[model samples]
Target: MTETPSREHRPEPLWAQAAELISEQITRDGLTPGSRLPTERDLCARFGISRVTLRKALGHLLDRGLVTSSHGRGWFVATPSTVREWPNDLESFTTTARRKGLVARSEVLEQLVRPATLDEADALAVPAGTPLLVLERVRFLGDVRMALDHAVLPAALAPGLADVDFTAASLFEELTARGVVLDRSETAIESRIAGEALAAKLHLSAGEPILLLDQTIYDADNRPILLSTVEYSGDRYRLRTTFRPR
Candidate 1:
């Protein structure tokens, strides 16, 4: 007699199926940055799931930086964090970085709020005592440690960040879903001496040459969302760009 196929052998989870459907909608609709998703009732009806089940699927997408919701606005596909230049546009950091044949990943070293420093206060346009969530990460390319970065975000703005899988996606993508649109950014690059943290994270010896970068990112309302200072191994990465004056 032939044995019946077991339910345990099903290829995907219930929530996963729902997540896939929602993901497809975002792609098919060409959802842009700051686009809002349908309401919970709508998604539930569309996916033929109960409210509890729909929320479960939405939670999964949220953790993956794929969707976001506000108190009254409902959910929306996250706006992508991207950079564009003529013939050279990078829509996502991890995707673009990987396309350059480099391995890219992020570790959520820290994800809690701490009091901002004077510098941080000025950069974020907040008071010195304002609470901020800090994220420290090491970036690698082809088995070589490339950069060490530290990012700070307004604690109140990104309440769900602590639940994100930093190892899997870009922080900017996650922030946008939560309503923090990265409207503009400012960057400063210079050479610097490596510190103990940088030395350890990048596996470099002391007194080595390194590249230092200070980057500030702002929301659509012109409020600072993240402030980061990065240190790159002198021998590992290069910055190259061409410009045509207007």
Candidate 2:
């Protein structure tokens, strides 16, 4: 007869196990946003773990953005918001919103034909002091202010653009109607904190998170037609892209 072989069982890491348990507890208890979690001591005892292990578990939750902590206050569930995906495409904000079955509107804050600044001239490949039409508008999704857009275009490319009714039509559509075909765009996005003026315009608290998009639009002949700086409410939007391996 062969001697029986012994088997050893390996357990999951204590902190990971604790994290899962706490996550389940949060769900089971129906904790909503801003709901305070139990004290550290209470969690430690309940999980039958030391303070270090409990803290590790909580750290995991914090890293996942599922919870947040205050200096004197305890941890609380994070507020969740609807995420709007912005794909890598040459699409206008109005078109994107319409596709989502949301109403989009614009409030033109300023529109004028002004001499191009050095940066604008460089981006548009035009000489400094060239007249450019600048359009600044506040965008709204239904009733909520969503973004602010500042677009600069060569006046020679789009004559009478400064007089166009931006509030009543899409900028891209207007340009297309005027025989300017936008073929592609190069864009960069970064996170930013809202300043007092911007926050007031967007109806958000000062220092709120926002997304800044800098784009240079080009025509089929690789001629830069427009440069835009768009600021979006961070909580109300998200950027997503799909990639395929070559």
Candidate 3:
């Protein structure tokens, strides 16, 4: 009987070969993320291939998450978003954005001090009616809107928080300056559909799938200090972790 060939033994297709050449060119040309690639006609001529073959090559890159397509605008290099936390690393949004060579930004939506409700008090292990600070922001990576962040904490723990402008600031850094360094976080993730108002803010259509990350961050004393919630576009975020078997 004739033997079937394994995937590893198969010859690379022309489209895949084109993809490799294009990937190398992206680096050689110094096209950073959000930069548009050369037009399809130019790529076709340079690769000596038909438009169909060039499209196939581009499609490969799209599947690899290396590029994104804008309607009527062609393909652009894409920077992956960081909505998922690194296991055991209490990294902040600005930290992750810097690591990815992107510009991080925030638009403050709401910030206020209010008395803690029973549920909020229970979550932070504080007594009811305790004064708490609440903040809501739209977070961005590069020029793309990435996630919406909302956080709550005891007002006394972070003084002058209301006076700080969050648009160009990092809450983690600000908290550290106030002597409230976060030590760890207990996180949970869930999937949900984006409703009308939420969709408008994120530039997504209603009913789009979104990822919700709910977490409570603690200090070195093991006391929960911040209750945070983030909503991420489904295609833009991924949570990763590792478990060591005992």
What lDDT would each prediction earn against the true structure? 0.68, 0.80, 0.82
Which predicted model would earn the best lDDT?
3
Residue lDDT tens for model 2, 101-194: 7777899999999899998899999999999999999987766577899999998896777778888578987898889999999999999999
TM-score of model number 1: 0.58
Question: Which residue pairs in model 1 clash with each other?
Answer: 37-76
Greater-lDDT candidate between 1 and 2: 2
Which residue pairs of candidate 2 clash? none
lDDT tens per residue, model 1, 34-101: 46788888777777777887798899987776775544447765423221111232134566666655
Q: Best to worst by lDDT, what's the order?
A: 3, 2, 1
Query: Every model's Cα RMSD, please?
Result: 18.6, 9.8, 7.2
Instruction: Kindly report which residue pairs in candidate 3 clash with one another.
Output: none
The per-candidate count of clashes, in order, stands at 1, 0, 0
**Which candidate would rank higher by TM-score, 2 or 3?**
3
Model 1 worst lDDT window (10 residues): 81-90
